[model samples]
Target chain A: MFATKLKTQLLLITILPLLLTIAVVSLFILFDVLDSIESEVIKRGDSITDQAAVMAEFPLYTGDVDALQEVADLLIKTHDLNYIRFVDVSGQLLLTENNGNDKGRLREFSSPVFSQAPDLDDFSAPAAVRAPLGSVDIGFTDNSAEAQRFSAYIKVLSIALVALALGLLLVYLFSRRLNEAISSLMTTAERLEQKDFTARVEENGSGELRNFQRTFNDVIASLEQNDAELQQKINAATASLNESVEQLSEKNQALAQQRQETIDLERSKAILEERERIMRDMHDGIGGQLVASLAMLEREQDSAVKENIHAMLTESLNDLRLIIHSLSMQNNVLASLLADFKYRTSRRLEPLDIELDWLVAPEADSLSIKPQTGLHLLRILQEAFTNILKHSGAGEIRFRAGQQQEDFLIEIEDNGEFHPDTEAMSRGLGIRNMKSRAEKLGGSLNIEKISSGGCRLILTFPATP
Target chain B: MTRLLAVFFLLLTVLSPVHAGSVHIVLSADSDSHLQAASDIKAELEQQDAPPPVTVRLLKPFQSFQPAADDLLVTVGEAATRYVSQSYSEHSQLYSYINHMALPEPQAKHWASVMLDQPLQTLLDSAVDIVEGRYHNKLVIAVSEENQSMRLQIDQLTIPDSVELEVLVIEAEAEPAKIIDQALFNAGALIALRDSRIWSGETAKWMLYQSYKYNVPVVGYSQSFLKAGALVSVYASLRDIAHTTAQQIIGWQNNQGRLTQEGILYPRLSIDYNKNIARALNIPLPESMTAGEQNNVRD
Candidate 1:
């Protein structure tokens, strides 16, 4: 609402005084002219009255009304007098004349009809003491003065109005140029707010306004130049940042590939370590025992003892074969390893004249286990089969493998019509060894007699464990 | 011939100094009238075939004068005349330019004065002539009480039968307006005297104003009064007095250091008319009076 305050202020500053000065000067001139007209009218009236008095002095003193009338008539006719009257010193009107042209206002002037003494040239001479024979009163009208005053007023007012109008026109023209300059600056300023630094005001107008426009344009130009330099710096920084990010990404990929190769090398080293451990255990346990048994066989005296030595030799050889078979398996599938173990055990049992029964569930055949768990399960099965072959006089041995929920279950049964003492079996090394192997496999082991009078051994472990 | 000529030049040069008697003229003031009278006297004395050595001097207060018995002393104006009369009684003194009423009586046989005032009868006759029979046969004379002798003199004069002279003796310190009003009442004309007590300062102005108020013409004693609204005035002009004084000095010098006229001698008189005042009063002036040698008509 107050946006155009400068324009309003500028117009007022220029026009108000112009209007006031014109009005004041015009009024002064009008009053002066009017006063001059009034003064002229009064002076003319006084002059005519004085002349009439001088002419009527003798006539009025002599009481000659005719002569007084002539003097009054001559004055009234020649001058612009409303009326003329000659009055004697006794206050009696002797003669009166009127031009009959009374209009507008009237101003009356009077002079005594003095019988003036003679003029004296002497400096010390006394002032003339004249008798007032009578008086002459003349009436003059101000109609002409009023007319002239009216004409002057019209002229003064017209001139004042014209001057005021001219002043307003000039002010408006000058202020328009100034406002245009200011508006242009404001518009450019708004553009600068929106960050359009290229915006600039036109250098228009004169004097200070023109200088202001030029200064604004110079500032905008400087800002535009600065913005261009800033944009260039930002672009250069962005490009440098993109290049750095791409190099970091390549370095991360190379580091990831090197980490993956190191992990594969660690896994191969662990598998080789497990194989060396298994070979060392075999060299120290079964290989040494075979050497001792050969020595004993060479020194045996009884034939039955010789047969025992031959049986021990055959079991060791069978254990060695089972170890070889387990080592040669491609994957750690429990069913494949268990099937190999059943074939090896059946051959050993057939030499001993015992029947072999093997049942492998399909779900149990796909179950995978760690290599160490497979070795523990095979060792436990070997211990149970040897016990069945040597201690339990069993004619047939049954083996079964299946899955129950998340667990894998394996059962081995022997039917030999022999009831082994529980306490004695618990104390036996083979039974203890079998139990120890089952515990290592993270499973449970149980030995019991079935209804058909055969011993049953059950092993249960988690399939993923 | 050379011897006779040398003897004659010697006798002429030696005798010229013996016959040259100096004349001293004393003035009352450095006033133009007094100076003019003194200069005229000196000039007239010098114009003689055997003129005396003349010197003019201004009279100082309380100053004494000692003149040779053969040397003549001329005093101009009232102060110088009075001063020389009292201080140098035995000297041959000629007093000029003093008012006739103000002149002192002669103390020696050769002492004389040229009076400034015109004869009273001459002033009255001029007043009569100015009225021109317009006023109702009445002429008023205004004088101060100090000058009762002047009023008596006017009473003793033989006035024209057509003119009735009325004398108004104004008292000293009295209101001049009342006196003038009384004097102008029913009078056709007023005659102003030379008495300063009656007609000087504001009293003089009141007299003129009352004279106009009554429509009465005033005949004054001096030219100044004539200019001051008087219809007519009769007096001795300064030139007339100066010429008479010069003639008297010449006569005294020629008559063996004694004045030709004795006592208070009146100078040649002059009459001046205010034509404008005469016309304003509706008094017609006779052509004979206007065309006279002594008449000076001021329009």
Candidate 2:
């Protein structure tokens, strides 16, 4: 943008004043020369006319036409006049001579011939007063003077044109140099914008342009040096940042390993706790019954006692099988654990002449629980069955398990005597054990005597623990 | 004897008229010369023992005049003489202040005139006096074709043995410079005659210019020429002509009212000199001519 603008500006600066001066000076010279030529022609015409008037006085006074004619002819031929006429004082033409050169512009000059008288007072001096005898009229052509003026005009014009051309050439050469210098600076500036600090301009031209070149080169050199220093600082900063990033990555990997180890240690500790809890339950429940059965066999050898001992051994094996089934279940499905409990309880109920009605909804069968939660739920159901078999003596029982809104519900209903001591039975060890196990499963258990001479036990828990 | 002689003379004187017929002086123009001649004539007639009653009258153009046949009519200038001679053909007339060339022909037996021009002998003598042995003793004169009578008069003059006279007759239409140039060639003096065709106005100026260019002194016929650059002038003065006219009128009265002179008369001549022109031309005047009362010398 700047280069194009400067080119036009430089051209105007150089050529405008030169053209104006040449035009004005040429016009002035031409006008002056033409005016001078015209004046000279008029002066020459006046001189010739004055001489003719003096020579004509004698002939005019004597009324000599031939003498007047001869004077007119000689003057016309010698001075290149178009025509000459001698007129008397009354304006009558006495004699006239012409050369037939009356083709172009003409200027006429006239002078009066005066009658001379001798001065009586001063013998050597002519008289001061005179009377006009006649006049001589001369017609001078402007052809020669016009030709000279035209030649002068051409010469001045030619000189002006040649001078203007030379001036234009010099202006073009100088402006071109200036444009080149400015263009170099512009190119270098554009490179500087693109972060190419190595770009520089050549120091050329004169005066202000030369100074501008040097200043621009100095600025570019400073920028290049600064850019190099900044690049070095940036490289140092990048190296330091990379080292910090590497250290951070290593620290993050170590933290991740430590976290995984801690997680495994927590899981192992939890599993060991669960195993100890299972061993304590078996020792407390099945081991105590087995020891009592053995003691009774040792004391009495009756047939009924032997049969009771065999039943006790079978019950302890069933409890062991239920615990193993709950522990082996996948994802701790509460329905599978519940089904295993029912199978064992139903067989026990068949021997006791009791009917068991089991109903499990599809959603209840697909319900998932934690392994510990499933084990707690299975223990809760077993406790309920044991109480029914030993105390309530119900002939039939119904069990139902399904989802209710955002919670799960399990119902166990038995047709049994409505004992007036139901509140006392809820305080029994089996019922307390079921309640404790239900609390551990994140659920609740309730046993109540129904109005229909049977009892219902309900367990409800949230769907997601 | 004294008583007898005195009675006889007294009887002769008693028969003579105490005054002649009245003298009438008529002027042609009211010019100074004509008026002066009339006054002189009246004065001269009054000086007589018994003078006539002179009545001076100016002649008007186209006016009638009938003079007494016996009266002596004294006409001044050429115009009054011509008019009186034509109108009163038989009247006794005496003409004064008239040139000889312009005088009227005498028709009456008693008419006479005192002419203005001097004789050729007198003009030549004045020219010789001005030349004074300079320029080879030669004299030059120019005359126009109209003045052939004057040219004949010049040819008839008795020129002196020591002098050579050259006469040039110019044509009426010819160039005067060529003729003047030829006349002033190595001449001692140039004699200028009073001819309107050859020597008047611009022609006269040219002649004077040529005369100066040739260094020849000019002898002119009038006082004006002397002032105009002539070395000497020979002409008749108006006072001399007036005095001459007074003499003729007295003579006519004395001769019984008839002019004593029968034909044209000549006045006494006067000469004038321009001392400056004489010094410039290196010519000397004769001592006698310079000392004369009529001689006039101007710077």
Candidate 3:
């Protein structure tokens, strides 16, 4: 029945138009149904109920007993209400339910509304509008106007259904064999969209529809097949962008750190270099003087003097040494770096016996890369090791660096916990600094959990080319 | 007394009829015009004072044998069985006139034949010629009486894009007789409503897209047709023409249970009928006749 030439094409044509039509129709019908139901149901309330209440109350207040009764009874009968009564000041039962205010509840405000209403006299004489008479309450039972709305809704639904069925049937027969072609094309197109580019629509239905489907399929297949190449390009572009962004972020952080360091220097505002020279002089040249002073205290047996000289002089020399090291020689090949790194790391991690393994690959020994690159690599490794020590509870870790194919590769693996929760990883300085260092050298890094258990940090850097 | 009067009149009628000469009026049995002629004569003669002794003879629509070296064109009644049976024996009778009847709308044919004392052929002839297409080598317009023949070709040459060749069946052979014209008109109307843009496009992709994404209704007579991409159709009716012809026989006879001198024309129901179609085609029939799917009408 749906035998279309280009099965997929005709199918798409039939389906899309039909679907668009149906969707539009359904939305239209739904809104239409809602509007009708709302208007009609509310209309039901506004028209009959509103009218009955307004009209019935009018005569009741006008002091015309007969007219009031007639109006009340009419409203009651027309709308099928239950009771209509009035009350007056008499405390007598004159006008009952059928009558007027002669027999009803007391007209006092304080009267118990829940109790049966008192009575009063029927309207008489000048018809004083029945005194601010008791209230008039009119109501309808539980059959709200929802029923009408529901029926209208049902009618709309059925009509839409039947119309849809008929429309489909017409296209089927009229198009006949063409539908088959359309269907086959559609199948092929679907497969193509799912990344099956090899799929081709059958060019077998009506010639034109078939050709249409086949051509479309061919185009889609090509587009799909080329997706891999496209992805490669996109990924390369993305990598470049990410590298730029990372460099920018690191520059910004460095600028901020420089500003903070300058601020700290201002606060500490001292010629620490001059102070270190003075301290060195004081230590080397005045050392004998301090020692002789301590000796005089001991010889005189002045414990107070001895303790004061010992504690004060001893603390001064240590501070002087710190100042000298910080201000003077920032570059010390063997002892300086090892001692600095050791002191810094040990000071940080000694409290927790976190293990640290440092391995230099063949390339580091060969020194093909600049010393700065080596230093940067060392910093990154240090940052990673610090992270492992601070966060990774793993009992063991391994760090290895190598060079292959004119590329430098570094691997850092930890055995304990692989990756910390992402929230924790995102918040810290450890990962950020490591990633920035890697990008600064035109290298990429992948941090992933190893299947064998734990996390691996793999960094590969391209050579100058 | 009433019984005796009836008996006496009946006896007198029998006795008087004993010597009356009989005129055997032979006609094409199922031919619409001849059927009309038969009914007209029957009504007229029935009103006459003692109708002349008469016997109306009826023959099949198609005849097989050659007419004794003197015959002219064969009527529809003579065209049938005659071709198959290969015999043409007992056909001579009173004067016969073969009327040049036009095709009528299906609705008109139905009401005229079933609910009214009118021939369907007259109705078919009255329908307007709308869109023209060749069907069975005859030009057919979307009409109410029947889906007359119309030819459609959707080869690669017709359109700019991939050509789609599809066959539209207004009335398939399944029903073969119950002619429901309104249904077919409905299908044709739907077809006419489609934008001309549907003719050309990459056929398969569009179709799959439409079916899955749009859930568009495919016009067809049955689920398969719909599955194959047909949206609607009339149920089995019009295709059963032979059965309908036989069924219409009851409507042809008079109160005396005798066939009318004029032949009767039966309405052909299509596989696609709808109520709006009757109005569109200007056929005066009750609206209840539209019980079918919505499918395209092809002659």
Which candidate, 1 or 2, has the higher DockQ?
1
Could you say which candidate leads in lDDT? 2
Worst 10 residues of 2 chain A by lDDT: A118-127
The whole-model C-alpha lDDT of candidate 1 against the native structure comes to 0.74
Per-prediction TM-score to the true structure, in the order listed: 0.41, 0.39, 0.19
* Best model number under DockQ: 1
Predicted candidate 1 versus true structure: per-residue lDDT over B1-299, tens digit per residue: 43443344334333533323456777676655555566566566567787666666668722644457676777877777787887777777888777756677666557877777777887787777765466476888877787865876787777888878887777777876676677677787888777767677645655787788688988877888766888877777776777777777777767877778877777776777788987887877767567875455221
lDDT tens readout by residue for model 3, B1-299: 43443344335434543222333333444334444444444455555455544333345312222232212111223222233123322322112221112212222111112111112222122111111121211111211223332222111112212211223333333221112222332222222111112211222113322322222222222212222233333222322322332232322322132223223333233433323433434433222223223322222
DockQ of each: 0.05, 0.03, 0.00
Could you tell me the lDDT of residue B54 within candidate 2? Answer: 70
lDDT (10s digit) by residue, model 1, range A397-429:
888888888888888888865476879877778
Docking category of candidate 3: incorrect
Ranking by TM-score: 1, 2, 3
Clashes of each: 1, 0, 183
Off by over 4 Å in 3: A1-13, A16-31, A34-38, A49-58, A64-66, A82-137, A142-146, A171-178, A182-465, B1-299
Candidate 1 vs candidate 3, DockQ winner: 1
Decreasing lDDT order of the candidates? 2, 1, 3
